[model samples]
Target: MDLEGLLGPQHPVAAAALISPAGVTVASRGADLDADFEIGSISKAVTGLLYADALERGEIRRESTLGELLPLGDVPAARVTLASLTQHRSGLPGLPRSARPLRRAIALWRHGTNPYGDNLEQLLTQARKVRVGRPRTRYSNFGFELLGHALAGAAGRSYGRLLHERVIDPLGLDHFYLPKAVDQLGPNALIGRNRRGEPRQPWTGEAIGPAGGIRSSVRGVARLVAALLDGSAAGIAALDPVAPFGKGARIGAGWITIEAEGRQITWHNGGTGGFRSWAGLDRDAGTGAVILSATSVSVDPFGLSLLTEHTRTVLNS
Candidate 1:
């Protein structure tokens, strides 16, 4: 499928994987399939899966609220429903209010310092002050962060532990991990680069793990997609659309579904200070594709093209 040609020479290191009924095929430009790259907001999709899994286990319900799970006191965020959070209808802001959000942004741009290094306790502290608006489909990192922690609290475990026990371990996704700190990253983890080609620090924190702090290899991502395709993933139902998102889009738990070229594509894209990732699935065609790059550039067009193009090939084949 000319992965190299599609990726071009801009990316310093990138990996791609395509899965179909024909089986899985993976290719990389500068890194091996086992090399991990921060998947940014794709972490939300993983959290979405965990959210569904917890629901199925009777540990949490769609009606669950921040007040019912975490010690957020009687804040407005506490009244937000799990279902609202999953579908981005919780009315929480994209990020919890910061004392100096502009300073954080400038630091990230100039120095690539991690801005979301808050731990669980700090996260709860910030959440307690959040003022949730009326329920509507608005993407919110803060909401997902809270949702993931709430799920963990319900199961009496940490978010990382719950993720491992419920998803990674069960699927044997050894390369998939959530690093609560930079020290937890392994040697195989790639150092991401900003658009200017400068190396950036890895984004890691317990507070942000659920929203934008997952790392994985292309192989790990492909295997996860295969499970989702075969309905073996514990939270397969999370991919089902529950509410309308932006124009011409519907969102499920964390995944967004859209119609393109007459094909329904369920997908998510992520970007941090230095990394970018895209994953998409055409379930009816049993085809999926993922693109991960160490450079902070958009991979959505490539991922969508690969999946849709691959779907046609699979149908013809």
Candidate 2:
């Protein structure tokens, strides 16, 4: 499954890194192993890990209600819980109606003055208007956004600060950060492009920072998967099959579950504007892979197949 030409003439820069459970990087691409990229929704996995860590430390309880933490005031869906948010069972709309308006505000802010502060408030107002769905499986970005806010409130710190203190700092993942502003990104950091090969301006993603704002490299993500495969003091753990929700499909905290070659595949994919990334771990074989690309093209099947094949080859050898 070759994806070298999938993006056509744009030729997106991509990096794939596979690692053993023992923390050895077995494969990689692009610059130094520690270089960073806009990792998109893979941030969800990190957020999940933070929640899990907080649960372990008794800083927050999974059963805690969102209303207790965020106090949605008059939002009818305030009954959501932390567990429901992480499991995508909250039923909130995937993207709020304010997304486009916020994006437009970000564009204008980039032109000269800052407009994202007002847009973020507008986004929160729009979010409160969202009606909850029946408790069921539906991918909702707003659910995670609420979780981020709730987690911050519970920890008594900002979301970015909490992430740094609990996850990145402990793991020694110096290259990863949730940028509060567009200028924080490195000049050489890869830019995302549309299907037509046009460069898209960087948008201030403050409104959805927790759901999809993380930036890291293939090597950094691979190291994270490595930690998950081998329980580390840094709080990473192997994928647990126990259904946190009812007896449904296997999903561990934040990572989705799939089966390949009779092995449990725990993985997540993320996309924002011009970037897409996928990361996974085969818990049965103690191997993991991370794929980062500078475009929004789907890379899941390719990343999964590569990880599965590579793990099989290495184990058989």
Residue 150, model 1: lDDT of 94
Best by lDDT: 1
Model 1 agreement with the true structure over 184-242: per-residue lDDT tens digits: 99879999999889999899999999999899999999999999998878898899988
Clashes of each: 0, 0
Span of 10 residues, lowest total lDDT, candidate 1 = 95-104
Question: lDDT tens digits, residues 174-269, model 2?
Answer: 467777677877644666665555555543456567787788866667767777777763435314544543443566666788778787788899
Q: Note each model's CA RMSD in angstroms.
A: 1.1, 4.2
- Give the clashing residue pairs of candidate 2, or none: none
Report residue 191 deviation for candidate 2 (angstroms): 0.7
Query: Residue 237 lDDT in model 1?
Result: 88
Cα lDDT, all candidates: 0.89, 0.70
Clashes of 2: 0
TM-score of each: 0.98, 0.85
Task: State the displacement of the C-alpha of residue 34, model 2, in Å, after optimal TM-score superposition.
Answer: 5.0
